[model samples]
Target chain A: MSNFSVAFRTTGSVTILALNGELDAHTAPELESAIQHCKNEGAYNIIVSGAQLDYISSAGLGVFMAFIEEFRTLGGDIKIAALQPKVFNVFDLLGFPLIFSIAETEEAAVEMFSKGTTHN
Target chain B: MTATIHTLAIPSATRYLKDVRRFILRHARKAQLPDDAIEALQLAVDEACTNIIEHAYGGSTKHKVDIAIIVDPTRVMVRIRDRGQPFDQQSYIAPNVVALTRQGQAGGLGVHIIRKLMDQVEYLSEGRTNEIRLTKYRTH
Candidate 1:
C-alpha cells in the first residue's frame, strides 16, 4: 500500500485537506485528485493541512504548482498550513513562499481565505 | 579514516522511491546524522533517483539505479549509478525559480533541490553508464 493518504473536509468557505505520511512522486497523483475534487465542489479557497506530513519531494511540491494557477484564476486559492519543518524546508528551498501563502496553523489559513487575502 | 561501503539497487521507477528513501534513511540513522542532515540527504537522493528514472531512462522502468553509501565519522557519501542514457551535464540549465513559479511550471525542481541539499554533487558518464555522487557532512 502507498504510504500517503489525503483526507478532505470543509470549514466555512475553505476546503481543508489533511495529508498524512510521505508526499513524493509516487503519491503526488493522490493529492492532485483531491485538489481536483475540491475544485469540482466549487471550492477555490483550499487549505492543505500538513501536520502529519512526514516528508515532501519536488514531485509532491509540483502538484501544488500545477493547480494553483487554475484555482486563483477561478477566484479560489490554495493555502498550506502546519507543515513539519522538514516538509516546509522543501517549499522554502524552492521559493514557494513567494508564490503561496503558508500559515502556521490551519485556522490561520482558513482565516486568510475568509479575508480574501490568499496571496502573500 | 576508511569507512565501510554499503550498496543498494532498485528499479528505475517512481514506485521504488519509498524503498530507496528507507534504505538511505537507515544508513543515515546508523551514521548518527542530525535530523536536518538526514532529511537533506534523503531529499537529495530522491531527486537524483527521480531524475535518473525520468530523464535518463525516459520514464522507462527497465533500467536500474544502483546506490552506494559510504558512512564515515564526519560525513556520508552516496554514489548512484544507472544504465540509462548519458546525461549531458554541461547543457543543463538551472531553472529560474521566480520565472517558473510565475509561469506555473509543474516540474524542474528536482535538479535544483538536489544541488541545494547535497554538499557536493558530481555527474560523470563512462561508456553506457551514468553515475552521480552526492555527499553531505554531518553537523553533529
Candidate 2:
C-alpha cells in the first residue's frame, strides 16, 4: 500500500492539495506530479494543507523548492499551511519560513494569497 | 542503561526510505530519546540513506546499504555503510536555499539538513567502503 497520498480540492481560483501520511524520498514524486498537474490545469494559486501530514523530509521539501519559483514566475504562488510541529521544524531548519508563505491554518494561507502578500 | 548496537540492511532504493525511517523511529524510541531528538534522528538518518541511494549507489537497487544504531546512555549514533562511490566531504558546500529555489533546483539540500539536525556527523571512506555516522546527544 502507499504510505502517502495527496487529494485535490478547489476554493474558487485556488487549488488546495491536502497531503496525508509520510512524505519522503519514496513518495515525493507523487507531490511533484500533483503540483505539476495543478500548473498544467492553469491553477496557479495553490495552498498545501498539511494538517494531516505526519512527516516530511528534505526530498519532500525539495519538491516545493523545485516548483515555487516556476509558480511565482507565472504570477502564482504555493503557500503551505497547518504543518505539524515536527514537519515545520524540518522546514524551519532549512530557513524555509523566510522563503515561503507558511500559515497556522489553510484559511490563513488562503487569506495571504487573496491579500497579495509577497512573502511571509 | 548500557550501550547496545542494532543493525538493519536494505537495498539502495528510494522505495526503501520508508523502511529506513521506520527502523530509525523504532530504535530511537527504544533509546529513550526525547520527542524532538527522535524526530531529528529520524530525519537525519533518512537524509543519509537517501544520499547513499541517490549519490553513492547512483540509484542502483543492486547495491545494499547497511545501517547500525549504537545506543549509549548519553548519545545515539547511527552508522551507515555502503560499497559505492564515496561522498566528497571536502568538496561539498551548503547550498543557499533561496538561490536553489530561484534556479528551480530541488536537490543538494539533504546533506545540509543532515548537518543541521545531527549534533555530530562524520564521513569516512576507506577502500571500497564508505560510512557516515550521525550522532544525537540525549537532552534531559
Candidate 3:
C-alpha cells in the first residue's frame, strides 16, 4: 500500500531498525540501505524487527544473503527477530531458518545480543 | 482463456514483489501448475529481478526495470525489461557453490541457482532495452 519506513536507534551495542510495511523487490533496497547505514556507523550487532513486516520475497531475502558475508567479514552481527509464520516459511524454504539467528521475540533477541549467545 | 498483464516500474526495493509472485501463481494454479513447478518459477523470477536490481543500474535509484508475466493454460512466462546497461548472460560463468560454501563465502550463486531451478532461460537485446525470458511448463 505504501513505501516501507525504517528507523535506526541504538540499543546498547546493537542497532535496531524499526522496519514496517511490505518487503518485496521494490522495498528491499531500503532495508539494504538501512543495514549499510548501520555498518557505516560501525554497529557490530543488528536486529531487524519483523513484527510489522507483512511479507518477504526471494529478492527481499537476497538483501540479507548478499550482506551477511560482508557483515561477518567486518566482524559485525546480524540476526532476525519475530518472523511471521508466512515470512518464516519463505526463509525456511531458502534454508535460512537454520542459518540465521532468529528469536521468538524481540526481547529474547536483544537479550541474545547482550549475552553474546551463539548465533547459528 | 484467462490472461492478465501487470506492468510495474521496478523500484530499487524488493519487498513489494510478493504480489508479483502471487499474481503469477494465481494463473499458474488455474492452469494446473504443480507445487514444485510453482516454487521453481518463483525462484527463477527472483533471480532475474535480483540481477536487474543489482547490476542493470548498478544500484542507482534513477534506473528503472519493467516486468511482465504472461500466463495461459499451457505455460507461464515472466519477462523482465530494463533500459540499463546490457548484461551478457552467455559469458557469465556461474560461481561454484561447493567452493563458495566450503570457503564459507555467502554469495554469488544467483545464475547458477536459477539455472538449476528453471526449465529455460533466454536473454534478448532490442535497441537499448534488455529483456529476459523465464518459462516453466504447466503440469496437469
Off by over 4 Å in 3: A7-15, A24-26, A36-43, A57-76, A89-99, B1-43, B53-67, B81-86, B95-113, B116-119, B124-130
Runs of candidate 1 exceeding 4 Å displacement: none
Q: How accurate is candidate 2 locally (lDDT)?
A: 0.92
TM-score of each: 0.96, 0.97, 0.63
**Every model's Cα RMSD, please?**
1.4, 1.1, 5.1
Residue-pair clash count for candidate 1: 2
The order of the candidates by lDDT, greatest first, is 2, 1, 3
> Stretches of candidate 2 above 4 Å error?
none
Worst 10 residues of 1 chain A by lDDT: A111-120
Q: What Cα-based lDDT does every candidate model obtain? A: 0.89, 0.92, 0.71
Residue B110, candidate 1: Cα error in Å is 0.8
Scanning candidate 3 chain B in windows of ten residues, the lowest lDDT window is B97-106
Model 3 earns a TM-score of 0.63
Q: Write the per-residue lDDT of candidate 2 for residues B63-92, one digit (tens) a residue.
A: 999999999988999999999999998999
What local lDDT score does residue B17 receive in model 1, on the 0 to 100 scale?
94
Q: Which candidate comes out best when scored by lDDT?
A: 2
Interface RMSD of each: 1.3, 0.7, 4.8
Give the winner by TM-score. 2
